[model samples]
Target: MKLSPSVSIEQSETGLEFINVASAKCDAKIFLQGGQITEFIPKNNKPLIWVSKNETFQEGVSIRGGIPICWPWFGNHQNPNWPAHGFARTSLWQADEVHENDEQITISLKLPMKQVNTTYWPHQSALKVEFILTDTLQVRLTTTNLSNAAFSYTQALHTYFPTSDIKNTTVDGLQGAQYIEFGEGPFTQSEHVSFERETDMVYTQAAVQQHIHTPDGIINVSRENSSSCVLWNPWIEKSKRLSNFADDEYLGMVCLEAANVLEDKVTLEPKQSHTLITTISWA
Candidate 1:
């Protein structure tokens, strides 16, 4: 990939390669290992993405924050031994293009199918992720079916956002959506969601836009081609068992993922394509 005035490729101390963007509008980093972005801070504003202080930047290991790409399958497969959240987050990606304009810098990356193990994902398809960085951030994940047969898959843009205090944070706009918590109750949401304990809610029929009210400010989150999303916080005990995360780190972060799980999974015919998008900005 050619270097631009606002973008350049850099390697971490652990040998992982990533693209760094430092333009007038923002500063960000996108790792090529998982096609994952671990940082995004708009100029003159607080960070819009949160990464764990103890995250491991090793080969084949997913970094613990930012936007992790969960693909092909989510959470777990029919077989219990399969890797949770699929293998996309640990797969190496090829940087396809980088462009810069007056308003933003865009980076495009694609998964190298040959590097992928067939045992995990045996389909012939193309996966690409694009990052649009300005004062706001936008991510687009596009999957294209290249084989003659049709296939179905589940995925999510697992985004982690920061908060001064989790207890004071609330997520609005899920008032009428249906959600399942800890494999229980496909119940309806009646008010703004807040965090008081470990939360893992999978929602369906969610509104296209949601607002996260943190001690810092209100962050607007919007999604496209997605009706399912996830809200999670490890709270205390669960946070202790999580790798690459501090025991009390849960107090400073929360995840509002744009996902396609359960009934929202996608099925594509040969030559068809689907794009799942999410945009973040200040409300």
Candidate 2:
């Protein structure tokens, strides 16, 4: 694959090597230590895959369609159609900038103004995603509407986390939260968060961050300007159809989506921008 113009590489204090794909609009981790992926991110756009592997240092949390960023709409959490989880995750992005130092590297990608979005989303806007990494990881998404008419949309950062066993894992920070059980599609559940057969609940008005505790370590998810969280694990059946997911892979990962949904649709006036920042730090 061709590297973007703004790409750069550097060494970190921990002896970790960083590879920033500024042009391809993504990040790559070519080196790590102790057989662990020191950094977690995506690679080139063809497969639109995220994560990297250096021998046993695999950072990939395989969930098939990569980390789908549902935008404009986060599927019909109330209905059944709307294409699983919306479409922003599949769209190709253009690199805008890249910067690197001994400790970290940052890469920015944008969805430029185009004639295509007029059909469904009739607003002129740009979606920008920034990848900021040290030995740790953070991703920030900014949406700017340049059209005269104001527009509203729901957004999500669907993260697939790696684990030894989902049964052994638990997500903290969602205690005593209420959610909508998506079967009749939007049925509300005002109960404590716990394990179920096929967990598909949308936790509304969540705390700005949460933690996914695995046997290995804790993956902390912190957000800014977001109000909703979705904790998902497709279990056995759903993992079969997805090519990028190994059989029964659902046992090893859970999706903790930092989202804006339902009554919380974000609106951007002309020349205005809305930003969603997510930081994934491990310990």
Candidate 3:
């Protein structure tokens, strides 16, 4: 892979390789492991993505923050012993393309199926993630089915965002969407979402965009090819049980993931493809 002047391959102390970008528009870091992006900061603005300070950059271990690519499946699988999220977050990816110009930088990565354990994912498919960075950040996850048979799956770009205070942060633009929290009813959202306790809400038929009101400013989050999303914050007790996460870190971050889960799971026939896109910027 030929890297431009603004981008280079970097390795962590734990031997994980990632691509680092520093350009006129923004600075970013994307790990080859899991095809995950751990940082993105625009030229004149605060960071739009957040990662845990306690995160360990070990091979096969998913970093606790940033945008963890949940693919093949999201959350729990049918078998209790399977990994919580799919293997994509822990699998290594190949750098397929990298381009930089004055306006922005684009990096493309492909997940090699040979690295995937067939025991978990038997179907033949192609998965890739492309990051387009400028004063704003855009992530595109595309999957193409290669097998003759049709297959279905659920996924999410589990993006974590920063906040000066979770108490004052609120998410707007989900009005009238249906959500299921803690396996409860698919209740209708009557107002903007506020965090007071542990929140694990799966929403369907959501609007294409939402605004996150943080102490720093309002962040605009928009999605395409997705009608579902997730809002989560592990407050208090649950925060204590999380690994590679500080107990009090919940107060400073929140996750509003653009996803395809539950009723919005994707099914593709042979030769078909699908893409899930999410873009973030200060409003």
Candidate lDDT scores, in order, read 0.94, 0.61, 0.95
Kindly provide the TM-score of model 3 when superposed on the true structure, using C-alpha atoms.
Answer: 0.99
Model 2 agreement with the true structure over 165-198: per-residue lDDT tens digits: 7788887787655577664444444433445457
Q: Tell me the tens digit of each residue's lDDT in model 1 across 136-176.
A: 99999999999999999999999999999999999999999
How would you encode candidate 3's per-residue C-alpha lDDT over 165-225 as one tens digit per residue?
9999999999999999998989999999999999999999999999999999999999999
As a whole number from 0 to 100, the lDDT of residue 77 in candidate 3 is 94
TM-score of 1: 0.99
TM-score list, all predictions: 0.99, 0.74, 0.99
Clashes of each: 0, 3, 0
Tell how far residue 154 is off in model 2, in angstroms.
Answer: 0.6
Model 3 poorest ten-residue lDDT run: 97-106
Candidate 1 regions off by >4 Å? none
Pairs in steric clash, model 1: none
| Winner by lDDT between candidate 2 and candidate 1 | 1
Error of 2 at 95 (Å): 1.4
- Model 2 bad stretches (over 4 Å): 1-66, 76-83, 183-196
**What shift in Å separates residue 101 of candidate 1 from its native position after superposition?**
0.7
